[model samples]
Target chain A: MELLLTNLAHGFGVALSLQNISFALLGALIGTAIGVLPGIGPVATISLLLPITFGLPATTAIIMLAGIFYGAQYGGSTTAILLNLPGEVSSVVTTLEGYKMARNGRAGAALATAAIGSFFAGSVATVLVAASGPLLTQVALSFGPADYFSLMLLGLIIASVLAQGSVIKAIGMVVFGVALGLVGTDVQTGQQRFTFGIPELSDGIGFVPVAMGMFGIAEIILNLERPEARSVLTTKVGSLFLTREEFKRATPAVLRGTLVGSFLGILPGGGASLAAFGSYMMERKISKGRHLFGTGAIEGVAGPEAANNAAAQTSFIPLLTLGIPSNAVMALMVGALIIQGIQPGPRMVEAQPDLFWGLIASMWVGNLMLLVINLPLIGMWVALLKVPYKYLYPSILVFCSIGVYSLNNNVFDVYMTVLFAVFGYMCSKLKLEAAPLLIGFVLGPMMEEHLRRAMLLSRGDWGVFIQRPISATLLGIGAVALLAMALPNLRKGKEKAMAE
Target chain B: MRINHRDVVAGLFLVLLATIGLFLNMDHNLGTARRMGPGYMPWMVFLLQAGLGALVIFVSFGKRGERVEVVKPEGIDIVRIVSVLMFATAAGTLYLTQYGGVRADKVVTFTIMAGAIAAGAIALWIRSPETDGTMAAWTQGEFVAFVAAMVAGVLAWYFIRGAGGYFSQGYNAVGIGMLVGFLVLAIPPGWRYLGLICACMCIFGLFLEKLGFYLALIGTILLACLAERDHIRKPLGVLGLTAFLLVLCWFVFIRELDIRVNLWPT
Candidate 1:
């Protein structure tokens, strides 16, 4: 406990520096800005803003990125309440009760509940992450190459199973993504793999171009295809504060949400994506306001909002400890870290304590900053939403063009972006989820490195994976998971759970 | 016939990619399983991928295909755009052969060149047979705008930053720019707005070095605005947007990030 407090105190010292605070503010602001945009989600927003982080230090960059992530979630829930436009899957649940509350003339109350509940859950989860990060890192330190490979394989399998569409298609995308990642020169032998002798590709495909092209520009293409359909609420936002009775109804739900979110978010495959959905389901079944569901219950908004924020905070444990990205957004984070030349793993905590703790400390600071900035700016954000898609999309295009061009101070990367945009559009039409592909792209090399190292150490013995207890256990769990997902009844349940 | 069209096509695409990967990776040394070569991991991955692709195809037969919907762009002119794209592809091929530093394999390289040329030829005759051949005033206007802008961009880039020798980036920029424009037709006609915006990015990339920041910025914003009919009629708004972007890029790119792209043609 003492160590946790002191470590957190040091983290605060690093995060509270003027430069870091300013970046956090900027990330949150940008996060909210794009989050309020009608159709772009958190992944798209982060990918769009990633270019700006290229110039900052690794810690500051990650601090800002984290701020942007949760800020977008905050922004997404705002739209869920006012416009019934949940920017991502997690916030789709928010729209259910959140939109109803807005129609009940409680827009201000709903917004406040989301913000406060998020702040509370975020505060709790930050402590949980701070307390648990080192312990998990210590546990991860003993993992062998075989164990690491199995764990990553398990992660890939889980990511594919959780994907919304066909499991086989998702697995195919994962394989395809790994193949794409293997392009450029090989690290071990210095032999080129799939560059086709293109000099630019010899260094491997640029991460930013692929990410920006796949998520950002593709989102623009998808958005432009549809006629603009945002219906902004013109009703006055009456009060920012909740009534005592409403607060009383929300307190217990917030507690329950924080508990549900923190626990699930630690699961390797379970990230923030399902936390809001899970909490909403729980609240509907058991909360005091269960009867009020579908009619704008405060519990519906409060529980899910808290759960979502807590889950977002705790999901970093996998990335920080096991070096496994739990979702596409986390995959982008790994890409950013790699670009900065810092390999993410158990070693990160010891080697870069400043980065490690500062990020943890900044999570709380960012949540607080969101609350401070959002309540007063609620009117401004809503008004900003009134900006038409025509103006909005062109500006994003120019940004993407310039941002990509600035990467190498040339146009080659921009060309890559164009290619990926077309490919991304095609993928959506084919109903393939890009998330698994992205996760695979980021983790593929690491998995291969571990696999090769383990094989070399074990003298080509494939049984080494099963021989190691941790590796065997993880692979066993993965096999069970794959089998369970194949079950007819379970597959039906999975489709329903992931349908949103 | 009852199989899911999306799954079959997606599966076939994956298979094609995996086969290509297998073929390309076949030459690399595949060492013993204990000490793997650079090709070993990729080779295994491709095999797994191809198997998965086959499985995807096989599974599709069990499910009914959903009718895929394609939305038409409300009133966008596509003929002038295709003509310009064809002209640029032919011209870009000439420039690439003359200057590109392509150390890529001859067979693969020439195949791409030939493909681009053939695609350009087909695009040259892309007008729908049902439509009358008489050109609209707007088509003529769009044709002039696109050709003039591209010409100015190429000339400006050539005179200014085109000093770099054999491996000039003009080749790569134009090559990738053609990729989206030519292949976009594979999707339904109504979905060509995607191609247009992609072309805008290509224009920006292709010209940023040659035309410099301000001119490149102006060309891209103007071209991008053409895609949305709502913004095209309002020239003042377009101009305002151009100006806004100019200053925004100046402040953000030049002042803030300190990226060294020039402001004007040297």
Candidate 2:
């Protein structure tokens, strides 16, 4: 405890530095801007900015970039709340009540709750990061490939069951995502599997292109097809800042989301996004005002936004401790560190304690920065709705394209983004939830890796997944989730089969 | 009396692609000790995808006479979309031409892309206010403004890097130059240069200089502009200005306190 406090104090001192604060503020501002622009998500934004971090100290660079990551989530909510256009998977839930809130003239409250909830969650989660980093490392060490696979399976099943819509459709999307994830080079072998002789196919499909295309571009296309019923915000923009009653309602949800996000964020695949979705689902389940869920439920906006930010913040744990990137943003952070000649793993904390601790502390500062940036901007973001559409959609496309291209400096990604956007538009029209597909896409590669790794280690023993206790527990959870999903269908099927 | 063509097309495409994938991967191996072969996973995925495709196809065909409500696409919008595509393709071709001896900087490249896309959006906006309007404006104006501001901000950032000599002096020169450049390029020449002032204020704010005055000035201009338009009778303009100021202040005191800021350039 003494060591932790000392480290935190030292971190705070670093984060409080004038230079670091500036970077954090810049990151938050840029992040929010990117978030507001549909299709340009944090992953692409972070990747684009990765090169700039080469000049700063590791801690400052990370703090700034991290600000952008979570800030984008906050920004994304603006679009979702006002326009019903979610920039990324985590923001999908935000679109539910967020847009409705705008329609109901509660855009201010929705934006406020999200901003405050994210701040609360971020602050609380920072404490958790300080307190639980070591403990979570211990838990993470216990997870092997089988355990991880089972955990991902559980995540998939839970997400499917908890999603709003037909369970069958969710499952189908999840299955499709998983299958699509298999399109890259075979991990077990050195040979290309699904590449139709396209040189790019040899490396397999990258998630960035597919994700950007489906969620970002496809959304633009679909929006273009139909006249938007309203602007991003509705009603004459009022003070949309949270009222006292809203604060009271949102505070608990923020706390809950923070707790849920911190723990889940430690896991490697789709942690932040999944936590966001899960938090919203849980919030809906527990809320007394369930009917208000799909229509301007403040908790709906708060929980997911808070959870995503918290998860994005806490996800640094695995990357910092184990040198494993659970998501694309963390992966970019790893690249940034490598460019700065810093190695990522356990020794980083000891060798570069200042850098690590500074980063963690700066997260607190960054959260404050985001709140400061976003709170007053609530009305401004709401006003974005009044901007003539002629100038709006094109700018979104440009940002999305630029952001996507900057990810790898590859035009192929831009093409892929367009393709995915078309796919996403189609999915939205078909009522196919893209979240499951996104989760599946992230988990697919890891699943193959784990499967291959387990197979290799066991020398062909398929029972490894069952034999490991942690793995078995995760599988158990997956089984439970699957059973939960199947039970209703089975009940319905019994009568149908009887009728047949 | 109809089946969803979109679903049918998607299903068929999925099935076709997966089949081709499986056939191509029929013999690959990953060098695993167990020799599960690289093709193993791909085959599994292909089969699963094929199965799902079949399932979707079955549903599409099984539910005969079901009226599918799809968002309709007008012929003109499709033409506009194609034009955007043509423009993007042309831009790419021009970019390639630049590689083939045509000179282009990052600024030029970005400007061209932004301009082309904006022009396409404007054309669409004039034709379709309901469907393509909001998105068009967002893409062309606001997003472009944000990008240009960011680019200018980045240039100013370079100026802030040095303290006095070539590094420091050059920093200020470039920073000022960037702001001025944006003021000229981004601001509309029309509204008594109201857009130009906003661009300048944004640039000043980015440089951590005395930005409050410009913020106020921009606010006043915006307010005047809004006031002139009777139909756009909302205090949102004022509210937005205030928000901008508030955000600027927050960035100053909280984020960049070390910088000496006068709040008025002149």
Candidate 3:
């Protein structure tokens, strides 16, 4: 406890510096603004800024980037509430109740609940990082090729379950993503795998190009096509704040989301996006008034918002301790640290206590800053609905392209982004949730890399996935997810009668 | 309108690509009898893609041609979007390649490229009266603001931290202080542009090593021009010309050449 307090104090000292604070504010403001724009997400934003962050000190850079990651979650809810457009995939749950609340003139309540819930979650997750640092570090250090592979397999299965859709489609997309990941040069053998003889392909398809294309650019194109369909709520803005009753209802959801998300976010292959969706679904399942769902339940806004923020904060635990990125954004953070000549692992805490502690402490400060900026700006953000959609949509596309191109100084990425933008739009049109596809994309490469590594280590023994304790545990969880998915079908008869 | 045709087409493309890929993988002599070869992964990827492609097609287009309902853009709207994108790409390329010192056999490569793109876009907008194209009218202010931005970008490059002649190591104490001052005072419309400038600065050192001193300067401008232009055909044209020049130079040095031809337009 003394060590925790001392570390927290030192962290405050570093984070409270005027410069660091200013950077945090800047990151939050920028992150929130971009996040409010549907389809331009944190991954594209971070990839764009990765090269620029190389010039800053490691801790300051991470503080700013991490701030953007969580701040976007806060901002994503704003769009969901007002426009019925979930800016981030995880924020889709927010759309069910958030937009309904807006239509019912409870927009302010929804916004407030989301913001406060996020803050609460972020605060708790920060503590988790501080407390669980050592144990997570042990998990990080002991991971071998086999362990890593099994963990990723578990992650893939969990991600598929997290994607609320046909399990087969999720599996298909995961396999597809793994195939795409194999396009680059083979690691062990110095031979190009799927270049199609294009000089650029020899290095394989770059992640930024594919990600930006599929998610960022695709989102813009889809938005433009549906400009007429978007119904913006211009009804009464309500109290412009969360009422006492609203607070009482939201507190429990926020706490539950925080706990669930923080724990899940710490696990490898888990991210804030997945945690957010998981929390939102859990909230719906537990809510007394299930019929009120999808029409703007306060719990919907509160739970997912909390989960997303907490997951964003707790995601750093694995990275700070184990050097494993829970998602692409976290991967970008690892890239930033590597550029700063800092290898993230168990010894990082011992070697650079100030950096670790300072980052953790700064997350709270950033959350506070976000709330300060967001609460009052809620009105302004809603008023933005008045703007003409034609202008709004184009700028979104431009920003997405700019963000993608900023990654590698390569125009090829922009072209790829355009391709993905169309694909994403098509997916949306088909009622195929892009979230599952993304989950697959994010986990596919990690799964393959680990799988190959494991195979090499175990000399082709497939049982390696179930041999280790941690791996076995993770696999067990995966099996349970699969079983749970099937349980609904088995109980279908009883469930129908109960419903009637 | 019904089934998601876009998905069907995308899935079909994937299947076709996978088939071709599978054939190529079989042709590669990547491994021997003792060890797994590099072709192994490619073949695995091919099969996986083919399988997934088939599944996506079945899910999306099966069940008696049942279609997935989707929102779609009109033909004209798509054209407008494509045009705007083309303009942005062209502008970015021109700005990066022309002034950023990317070497090429041409002068004012960025300006020419941007003009071509802007001209085409303006023409397209004018042709489509029904389309709002957003802007009420192309005003002097917009033009002046654009010119100023371009000039400012070039100046930023000139005074960048690592451009040398101004600051040691391109960004020593004085350079960083100046950069901060510039940022505070100028505040470029987009921070990404500023980031790009920093990139231009950092890559300056590498350019020095790759290209001879004189050529590096030229190459920087060429690259900057390409960065500003949308599609890179023009810059590639310049690069092609340069390659020709290099080949000629080789001929003169080793094979002896009496023929004289300056393929570069500039």
TM-score of chain A of each: 0.98, 0.73, 0.82
Question: What is each predicted model's overall lDDT from 0 to 1?
Answer: 0.80, 0.61, 0.60
Best by DockQ: 1
Q: For candidate 1, write residues A1-500 as lDDT tens digits.
A: 99988999999999999999999999999899889888778998888888888999999999999999988888899888888888888888888898888888898999999999999999999999999999999999999999999998898898898877778888899998888888888889999877866788998888888888988898887777666455656656668789999999999999999999998888776777678889988999999989999999999999999999999999999999989998888898999899888999999999999999999999999999999989989989888778778888888898888888777776778878988987787677667788899999998899889989999999999999999999999999989988987777787776777664
Where does candidate 3 stray beyond 4 Å? Answer: A38-57, A103-105, A196-203, A264-300, A318-356, A383-385, A400-410, A419-449, A479-500, B1-17, B27-36, B54-266
Off by over 4 Å in 1: B63-189
A232-278, model 3: which lDDT tens digit per residue? 55666677677777777778889889988898887655777678777
Which stretches in model 2 have alpha-carbon errors above 4 Å? Answer: A9-20, A37-62, A76-114, A156-207, A229-359, A376-385, A400-413, A419-439, A489-500, B1-13, B30-33, B55-266
Query: How does chain A of candidate 3 score by TM-score against the true chain A?
Result: 0.82
* Cα lDDT tens digits for candidate 3, B1-266: 34444445445545655665666565455453234466755566568767866766666654432232331322334554464556556555655665567555232343345444443343222212222333223333333343444444345544564555534342232324323322332232322232223223223223333333225334433433332323154556545544544453345322432222222322
lDDT of 2 by residue, B75-144 (tens): 3446556756566556655555655475544444444555445434433332221233332222334434
Model 3 CAPRI quality: incorrect
Question: Candidate 2's residue-wise lDDT over A1-500, tens digit each?
Answer: 99889989999998889999888888888778766765556665665445445457778888888888877777777787777877766787788887788788887778778887888888988887777766655576667766766766666676665554445455567777776777766654456655544566666676566655565545544544444433443354457557787777777788788888887887655467778877887889896556678768778888888898888878888777766566656756765676567867656777887888888898898888888878776666555535654334433443344344444544445545544653565466445677667667656766677777777787888788889998888788767656764565553543342221
Clashes of 3: 47
